[model samples]
Target: MSAASDIAKDHKLAVFPAFHRVADRKVVIAGGGDEAAAKIRLLSETSARLVVVAKTLSPASEAAVATSGAVWIDRLFAPDDLADAALAFAASGKEAADRAVVEAARAAGVPVNAVDRPEICDFYVGALVNRAPVAVAITSTGTGPVLARHIRAKIEAMLPGETGALARIAESLRETIASVFSNGTDRRRYWERFFSGSVADALKLRGEDAARRTAKELIGTREHTGRVTLVGAGPGAEDLLTLRAQRVLQEADVIVHDQLVPDAVIAMGRRDAERVAVGKAKGAHSVTQERINEILVERATRGERVVRLKSGDPMIFSRAGEEIAALEAAGIAYDIVPGVTAALAAASSAKIPLTLRGIASSVVFATGHDRHSNVLPDWANLALSGATVAVYMGRTVAGKVATRLMAAGLPATTPVAVVENAAHADERAFTGRLDDLPELSRRSDVDGAVLIVIGEAVGEAGANAAEPLAPLGALLEAA
Candidate 1:
């Protein structure tokens, strides 16, 4: 088995880092040419104390310098000139001088932006879809400026100018409004309710007075409590998790997770949270379902928020129904946080859509590892059907399923895709004819989070696609 660290290095999707906004800060533009003038004008819109340093200034910049009385050092910019600045923009003579200014600014703990030179820039200037306080910045990691500007323009079209005005009005009343609710929980709920209501937009449109009146009329004195959530952890990978599932994981306290959940996702939980393992690796389920039930009930009964983290989405084949019934029977409050089912995750990682236009429109999720069930699946209803079929935990019985399915009318040449460690960084995919999938899975190095796909959709394979496996059982359950 590959180490988790190795997986992190592989199969990882791109994540964008957050950038701090320069709402009000000192900025120095170290030139007086048109480039410097443009930078200066943009800075003027902010609260930055603008300083322009250039031997010869542009007509526009010279006019601003004359009027505003900004200190224009009418001499060559020395590297030491940036000693006491917050941000520096250099568009001066010679690459050597610009490099010097950048190095000096770095030494002085100041951010420097070198015009048209991304390597020397401490921060890239992004195109803004401005709602002022609620502005959206667009950047392409310094690769595509035009693309970023285009995206900004698209965003600008959707966001109204009134939104900025509204944000300022909201900001003005924050101190007074914040004092009304001292409890952190109440404050969070209050804002959530405010944003969801049409009245928040009205406050932006009709001004603060209308918002205050509306808030008073609608909001009551009772404390609004946040809810405890129960979420599916997925088989292992963080990438396999649903967006909604990730959001809940990021917010919850006292996460009671199964052993199958990936540590990477657990790391995303609150650092101060109580993480108790309910059981592990699925074999014979170390913690019985009844015991897990008692834990969830007891924790939730105490008013401490709890999340029952099961690998994969809890709804499919998972006994979430029994748990939901338990929570209801115990009168304990809870909500379901759906996760990407193992089948979906595997399919996604394999780039094979479970459903396709005209080829396979309907999909069924079936279980493969039912130890107690003597009956096999309905071959007549399932075989050769024009639908994507996903089987969960069907590794051992995959060949048997394929053989029976083919005998029942499924063509021997039908395409099948099998994914091992689906959505995990160590994920590997195999594809082949239905007849050969069982052997492929047997030979694969995959040990966990396996899923099988069988349908005409498999025939729609693109380059760089996975091979196959006999994973009909788990796929059956997942569907």
Candidate 2:
């Protein structure tokens, strides 16, 4: 089987996930015990008009009904109780009574959930990580509910508390966005930026009024021309990506990325965004630079928000200048969102200071390979320069780099650090003398991205110096 098909097979779900629009709709609950009260607490947060049928009401159940403003019927549940209801919950705490209610609800063509009874439940109430208008329900197919709730708690902790407020603001501004943009794509793009960018920050730091004002200003100054945003994807970790980069990704109508950009990073873009891999490796070019430039211009001229996602910071050896020149020549509007370069991330991950007072007072970021010219860079000057050197795209030429540095009168025993897949879960770092640079590069198992750090400051901060970084899942939980 094909890989996608195999994945699909592996993910065969026990229940199809869906959300019901129950606002201003009728819902029925049959019970009066703690079980029934629990269901009432869950549903009370929504706008559903609830009716409770129970022979007896415990203090907890009565209080729940009062708080939820649900109608109470002091009698047994009947088939007609489910009539015209969007959903029905059975929690009488008796097997026979629960079964009767479930059957009646099903017969009335309403989905039913029986508390603590999965077999009879047409649907289960999953643990919710509620950021209203953005609720995330976690389920385990009516089994392992405790585990689901545990997972939900973890998710809840990761989300920004003000996300719900931001969602509410977005809801209130939907009509305004639609009116301003007209096109669905444009409207979506605008909101994506608003949610991930300064508007969301304004909402969090100031208030809804401030956010609304900002939104209005953005709408008034909306750019009609297609634009290209050169986004830095950061060093193999989604969390390392900047808020502006995330905003641009979400707003893009098309994403053109390098092969080094992680799948998780690309997945941050709009679900409907077109993804094109125009990656260039050392010897192999899946798509040429000229073609890439043409594609950027083509997409922009068609009025699409184009995001050129480059690994690490676009300004640092990422060939962003060429793309910017292309956009300028074509008269297309464009901007840049800087990302955390791999060098900094590598240094941070390895707990190595890029520059230390007295020991290393300066830092130089240099690429080992020059794509435009075959002539090697001034390696002697770079080696002799009394500064820390962070080498980009140097893995293939590690031996040559070491040889040149050594020949330039640098000590063979200069501290060298190789960080592979910086800031990622499987990140690996190797620390040794400069003489072992080539061997370290060869030994690295990371197929994603590699960065080499050479200087006296390499292990000055000590090995494994920084606190472990959070994984991509933690970063995505907020979104």
Candidate 3:
């Protein structure tokens, strides 16, 4: 395998699947409250046989059970009740009881879902969009179900009902397709194009025959050879990703992404896309970059549409230049898709303006590379004019950064913000003056995609930090 193929495996983990199947299998629901009714409603279209065992079932739940003829134990469940279950769901209010049921179910080789409790879940009950043969699910990994449901509704709105019709038609004609495209790679390539285009739109506009004809055209246009696209994964949030990035991910033959790319971002690619995780964590070299650049260039030259998913905009300090250089040298077709970098995410989350009108109009982004030479950037000439300066991967060397800035005549008390794991849940931001930066960093745990910003713009943001953002948040602020 080429070096690019290996790096592709390392950086591709961002597009992992978020859903799986347990079709025509038995699942045990051991609860009596309204929770059981909700779970039953969700499973109404699924193939799983649901058994509800509770001391006292709600009247509505009992009615649902009666209508479905679902087995109701009408009492507490024993550990052995899970023996034949492929999956289990428990919603008992008692934490201890939920834990016991979850442990028992897992011991029985059954995946368990405890309602609203992340600690007890073996898997998760995600938000869903049911269109049969084409069901879609949106999950928050149990962090925010309401948010998940809202997002699922949006996704459901985006998908046309014709998608289900298209899926059914494909299934009915599967034998013929398999025979026509004998090789698995060719078959995959064919479907990748078929699903990518306006087949559903064509079927809605005309009929299945027209859609089939279009699918054939797509198959002819696609080569079975593999290609790699070096796409920026855009920080750690799925929403932070660009439309172009998602479009590429959907078409990616293989994805090599940074580890800092959120798990949710990785799940954006096609369900079957192979994902690899390369450590792109700032300041830590896990997969030496020479190998990654070679991987992208080699894979693309082979006619593969490989996506190189970085943590942020590929152009910003992200070795996009090096990879593009290799691709250009080899005459491979590729393009860069910009994304929300960690600095922007951090600045927005911390409510610090890297640049603001009058307060600090000019912004500078620098690394700590001058430390070995004991050289401080000319802060007086570059930053003394009230500009915001953002330092990427400079939190560990905060003391040196501050000393140089002070020497350059920037205020010792210039507002500084240290953001860790920007745009992610449980993200922490430390705000202080340059003088107190080192002590603040010591007291906090800064890990995973850290960034530093120093300037008066941060202080100006503090003036109206509580106010609502302007209509042009993306333009006015970096969020």
Candidate 2: where are CA atoms >4 Å away? 1-38, 51-67, 70-86, 91-111, 126-139, 144-224, 237-251, 262-279, 284-298, 319-340, 344-389, 396-414, 421-428, 438-449, 455-479
lDDT of each: 0.72, 0.83, 0.73
The sequence of per-residue lDDT tens digits that candidate 2 reaches over residues 17-116 is: 8998899999999999999999898999899999999989989999999999999999988888887999999999999999999888878899999999
Model 1 sits at a Cα RMSD from the real structure of: 9.6
lDDT of 3 by residue, 1-479 (tens): 99999999876632234555657677788887788877876776687787888898888788878776678887897898897787888876667778889989878888788887886677777788887888777776677788998998777766766788788767866786798889997886666656654565488899888987766565456564444566777667887777767877887867888877777998898777778777655577678778887777767666666888888778887778888787777777676788887778778888787877768778887775563644357554677888788887676667777777787787876877777677777676666677766653354345556787888887755432222211233224533
Model 1 segments more than 4 A misplaced: 1-45, 49-88, 92-226, 232-235, 239-247, 279-284, 329-333, 369-371, 374-376, 379-383, 437-446, 465-479
Judge candidate 3 against the unseen true structure and give its global Cα lDDT, from 0 to 1. 0.73
Q: Give me the displacement of residue 153 in model 3, in angstroms.
A: 6.1
**What is the per-residue lDDT of model 1 for residues 73-138, given as tens digits with 9 covering 90 to 100?**
888787777765778988774688788778878888888888778877878877766666786877
Candidate 1, residue 174: how far the Cα is off, in Å: 10
lDDT score for residue 80 of model 1 = 73
Better of 2 and 3 by TM-score: 2
Specify the highest-lDDT model's number: 2
